[model samples]
Target: MDQPTRQRRGLLIVLSSPSGAGKSTIARMLLESDKDVTMSVSATTRPKRPGEVDDLDYHFVDDAGFDAMIDEGDFVEWAPVFGYRYGTPKAPVKDALREGRDILFDIDWQGTQQLEAAMGEDLVSIFILPPSMNELEHRLRSRGTDSDEVIADRMSRAASEISHWPEYEYVLVNRDMDQCVAQVRAIVAAERLKRTRRIGLVTFVRDLIGPAH
Candidate 1:
């Protein structure tokens, strides 16, 4: 087989950080490098920017559609942010898990909490932080995309977000982008080796013990 053929144990891998903290970048790099893993496409009421495609960057929806999905209990996790609502749809992620593929989530801490509540042990959560406040501010300012007002708002929120670091299973300080990617990759690799996540290994191990010996 080209890849692991046994049934894929579904995993809900979450990477949460405040805006400009590089969670999205790390998530994308992980998806690009791992064949068995994929990004969870989120449903959103936020308007798509130029060159964004449906079911790629997001499953763009209107407020009514989003409400309908919520009413139907179709979201694993969802939240409103900056005047728009975004959510992870339940069905596709469930299907992906059944296929032995892992799903990656780049969302906020609140969404992480909801996902953990919905899926429990299947979720692997990581919290990423900037090396320092100065570095964080530098990253936010370097973009030159946010206005002074928006940047201040993001910084204010970052403080509260960082306060929740202890809530995650892992904490990664993204001082160097490459190092941060490596750290996240290591976390995924370690999680995949977890005994509970590899139930199939039990049978294989028992076989090695032999029937009569």
Candidate 2:
């Protein structure tokens, strides 16, 4: 007999890493390859830049609107960055979860912690680390977009960020980008198949046995 289809709950996949550690690249590849996952659009208080769509690029709101959301508990997690507030809105995320669609988050360790506190069971947090601090600095220098002073600052912050690797459910050393991406894909596959997430399994099994059993 053909097997019954199983419906699973969606996952909140979080990728956190220091600058130049390759988390962003991995996230891009995952989204490109997986139709079920999409990047999380953050609500921001920053003014919309030229050519940026309000809801597609970000949910742009004024300071008062953002403050109202915070007061009303409409955000899963939020933080101020360079004088502007950015946050994951709760409604879209909840809708995605109910529809069994995965959402990818590219945030820092602190935001990951807040998300975990809000939705621990649904979160699959991963931290990416460079193979070595020296390699990390090399990657930053190779970008050629920063001054020496900025590179030094990033290196300093990288140390602090790397210290939080223990907080994540998975930690990957990005020695090889392809290999790392494969590992992340594997993690997503396994997490999707977990028994707790497979909400339709009980019914599937019951239907398999039939009424005569």
Model number with the top TM-score? 1
C-alpha lDDT of residue 82 in model 1: 86
Candidate 2, superposed: residue stretches over 4 Å from native: 1-4, 46-52, 210-213
- TM-scores of the candidates are 0.93, 0.90
**Tens-digit lDDT string for candidate 2 (1-213):** 333345888999999999999998999999999999999999999999899999998999999999999999999999876478899999989999988899999888878989999999999999999999999999999999999999999899999989999999999999999999999999999999998998887778778888676
lDDT per prediction?
0.87, 0.92
Candidate 1 Cα errors over 4 Å, as ranges: 1-8, 211-213
How many steric clashes between backbone atoms does each model show? 1, 0
Question: Can you give the lDDT of residue 115 in candidate 1?
Answer: 91
lDDT by residue for model 1 (111-180), tens: 9989989888889999999888888888899999999999999999999999999989999999888899
TM-score of 1: 0.93
